[model samples]
Target chain A: MKLNSIHSITSSELNAFFEENRQRTLCYLESRFPVLQEDDIEDIFQDSSITLFLKIQNNELLDLTSSLYTFFLSICINIARNKVNRSHPTYLLSDNITDSDFEPIRNDKLEELENLVGYEIAEEQTDQEYLNWIEQQVREGVRQMKPPCNQILWSFYWDGLSHRTIADMFGMKSEDVSKTQANRCKHKFSDFIKKVIASYER
Target chain B: MKDNSIYNEQIDRFLKGQMSTEEEQQFKTEIGQNPELKQQVREHLYLIRGIKQVKSQEEQKIILQEQHEQKVTPLRRNWIKITSIAASITFIMVLSGIEGSRLYYRHEIRQYAYNASVGVMSDFAASSRGTIDEETKVHLTDLFTNAQEGKDLAETIDELSRLYVLTKDEFVDIEDDCAYQIGWFLAVSYINDGDYEKALEIINNIESEYPDNEDIKSIQKQLVEFLK
Candidate 1:
């Protein structure tokens, strides 16, 4: 499949891409990066998969010229690189390292990595374990949130679709209507998260 | 809760890096000065990241099963044949009021092979007494004690899984070794519950990581043979 075709990517096709490349990617990672253990390799693979999905959704791959596997592996490599640089995230998060945890990469290494991955890597933020935990609630909220709101939030935030595109997709009356709906869904999701977090703390 | 919907668009732009540098700088100043805005920014990040994780997991579910099948259960074509045996494995050591010692089975396949797996788990529990971490040691004792007494099989499996994942994330090789040891007990726990497929999964994975262990190989052979 052409890399350019990601503009119209659908769910099934993306799953097929995953099933097809899943083994080969593991084999590739195991051979190329001996430092990563099995679980770490799987974690990196998942992160890279999400990164690829987000890039495609945002239309950020317009200039890419590599084949699908090459593009995907480039991501895995960069993530593995980051994995090597970090340690057990549980310890990091347990200390509540809020501001100091988002350690910026050195300029020289950052440039080298950015060039290799063909895109900018986010500055290392706080521990991924915390992000992973927060994401768990977000997922539950999305599934249990009111209908149309959940669907609308997914299409808007996740798919990166514009109001016009979402309106066309959802068959809403107009872009303005879709925008209003998307805004409401975002608030509902945010509120959903707030309530859930408060409950967990209690 | 106050209406924070007005800041949604601006937060989205800031989190998504859609803001210009100057806009981002001004927004960062505001966020630094306001605790509520900082909290909102985190929640929005959670929503965006969480939804994307959910979608990735949808794809992940299929691939994980396929990965499991590829590593272990290649004999899935004969799955129906095995299920028809009405297999209900019973560990005699499970003295938790779950039918004292009468090996419960509908078809009565060779009982000794399954017992051989139970023996392996008992030996692992014995040897693991003092050589592991105190934190893991506590769970390890409960895992085997519950297995021996046949207490709450579901909870045992869940706790073992959690323990395995937590130890693995700590990035210590000793914990990895401990986790592999724990896999044997978990596999037996599944076999005890008559969950042969899940048992085969852990055994096969352990075999892949440690191919030379004759005991693990023997357990795998016995499982496949009994299923046949």
Candidate 2:
């Protein structure tokens, strides 16, 4: 039987595939990142499998160019790398690591990072101290933004709500109005950061 | 201001990956030519990343607190424990049921083969009198006697298969009763040797070819049920 597509796989077949490839994925991670604990490897494996399964279920992974094992390995590698980045940021910085250096094979992660962060920051290499400083500045800017602007920006970006949803929440004239307001708020916030950076430089 | 709005819209589309291949290439070319626009894109990206990081930390703290609360609650803990036990029990029960059905079907097939063999032997004895050649008759009688006497059943089955093929080739004018007796003997030998697949195949053939034969029909029905 030629099982080329994910749709053709039965539940039992899927479970068997996961069980068989799980050990191989763990072994791959152990080889690549020996410092990762057994528990961390297991967590990465679980998270990768769940993410892959959900993507397949939702029809997000429509065209698979590689074998299932290759796809699985890529997901595990990406996840393990991200966990390492989060837990050992200083170590990563010492190695002169950057976000762009760890380009994921899966396009979903790339798209997600791009949407959450901007392309430049997503690609830039920086230390944890710089990241913390920028985070502080962003929080301050958000806090100082006038009444509804902060709330609108929070809803649109942080909460991942749509302009239409924000418009409905805040009783705006339309989705276009919500979008315009969001852009204005983003500019205002950006100006706050510029002022802070200018003062800090002086 | 118009250029900034257009640039922001373009940046948004680029970040979201909503652009076509051609548009993306064009935007990339534009970014390469313009350094100030590139800087603006970088700054915007950093701001977005910082905000996301702060929000993510807050969400993580909320998640950790919720998990801690769930662990502290005795009622929730008891419910989770009970559910896990119930699920384990149900899984074991399902596994046992599948194994039980497999054993039951095997027993049914063996019993049916034994009864069918006895009936075929009697029919052979009654029908073989003066019609079959003396030498062929002796050979078949010896084979059946050895099978009944609890001798090597695998050897008996192999001899039965050869005898069946010989009968079909050499005895064109043989009685219908004798021909069917040979086929039945071959099938029952297969069953006794635990070759149910071959036994079922012969039984199905007999049933289809002799649709009016009640005995073959009954055997076919039993084999089908055992298989199911």
Candidate 3:
């Protein structure tokens, strides 16, 4: 059986792919940004993997001209570069991180997947689309939370920006301040969701 | 607030696999024993998942928007917004009818996937690890190519099935995915030969042996999307 470019990817296959590239990807990131902690590097890689998984899940990726690992590696590097640039504004990134990097692969498969998720949820529960409903509340909570809390939580939670990067993005004094603020904002966001859920339940 | 913070941190640790085995065991036991703690943990999980889901949707939108440079329409989820408890019950009844039709619909799925078996050929070509000689490899290629084209499909499929049985029984302990990839090809051949049930059985067996293998799962998902 002759396989062409990887058109279909499974979650486990992707995990294997990520693990296969882990050591070399780590070396590449570390050589570029020595300040990155192992945890940070791990987080970046995991997030990139999740991004790739989401793309595959959403049917936003497939029909690769090159190897699957090559496409995956590009995603990892793109994510890392964005993180480093945000986390260290003083450090100059390249001039030509082009806007035309990758075109999101799209088709009707996304809608099909959405309907599949919806169907699965409906199969599991009947009272409400509570999962999606609560997710909506989370989105609202981001908006309704106090000025900086909304912005802070949006960056930290919705954007998956690191606390230090949040600090840098928001012009906060330090990461500690950012963490504390995020904690407060997260609580408020939780409260906002809890309150709405309580009413809906009633 | 500090208590909530401490509680949330513990949940975060557990979710991120940052907890030690002993600590994780203790946490699980506590959740088992304590209702309030369990609820809190569940709430934390839900909140984090909810936030991430929102993030995922937003990122998808951004990507799609960039691709089309046009406004992506809202998710067609009003059907999912299946309002009212009475309507939900009705929907469930309707769903039960769907469940009944599922098997009937599945044959069509099998037919579509059978036609899509050429994908397995790509899986074979991309692989580099095999002890098979050049002559046998050429023979297999000709067989697959003949099957792929419109020429002598049944005869081609029969020859492939013979090779499949010979290969499957012969390569019991072959290391790595080569054997399984061959199984995948044969399963596709079975489908092509109008033995959808046999193809599914073979697929299920492969899944049982290598539960986490995505190649098999990808095929499964592709087939199921017909139902979806």
CA lDDT of every candidate = 0.52, 0.54, 0.49
TM per candidate comes to 0.38, 0.35, 0.37
Model 3's number of clashes is 12
lDDT of 2 at A133: 42
lDDT (10s digit) by residue, model 3, range B61-139: 3333222222222222111111111111111101333542343233233323323333344334434226666676677
Better of 2 and 3 by TM-score: 3
Score residue B41 of candidate 2 by CA lDDT: 70
- For model 3, the stretches where C-alpha displacement exceeds 4 angstroms are A1-126, A129-135, A143-147, A158-161, B70-228
DockQ each candidate and list the results.
0.08, 0.06, 0.08
Q: Which CAPRI category fits model 1?
A: incorrect
Position B36, candidate 2: lDDT: 55
How close is chain B to the truth by TM-score, in each candidate? Answer: 0.43, 0.49, 0.41
Candidate 1: share of reference interface contacts reproduced: 0.16
Provide the interface RMSD of candidate 3 in angstroms, 1 decimal place: 16.4
Candidate 3 CAPRI assessment class = incorrect
- Ranked candidates, highest lDDT first: 2, 1, 3
State the local distance difference test value for candidate 2. Answer: 0.54
Residue A93 accuracy (lDDT) in model 1: 26
**Can you write out model 2's per-residue Cα lDDT over B142-217, one digit (the tens) per residue?**
7775443224556877887776676567545667656676677677666655566888887776667677654466
Better of 2 and 3 by DockQ: 3
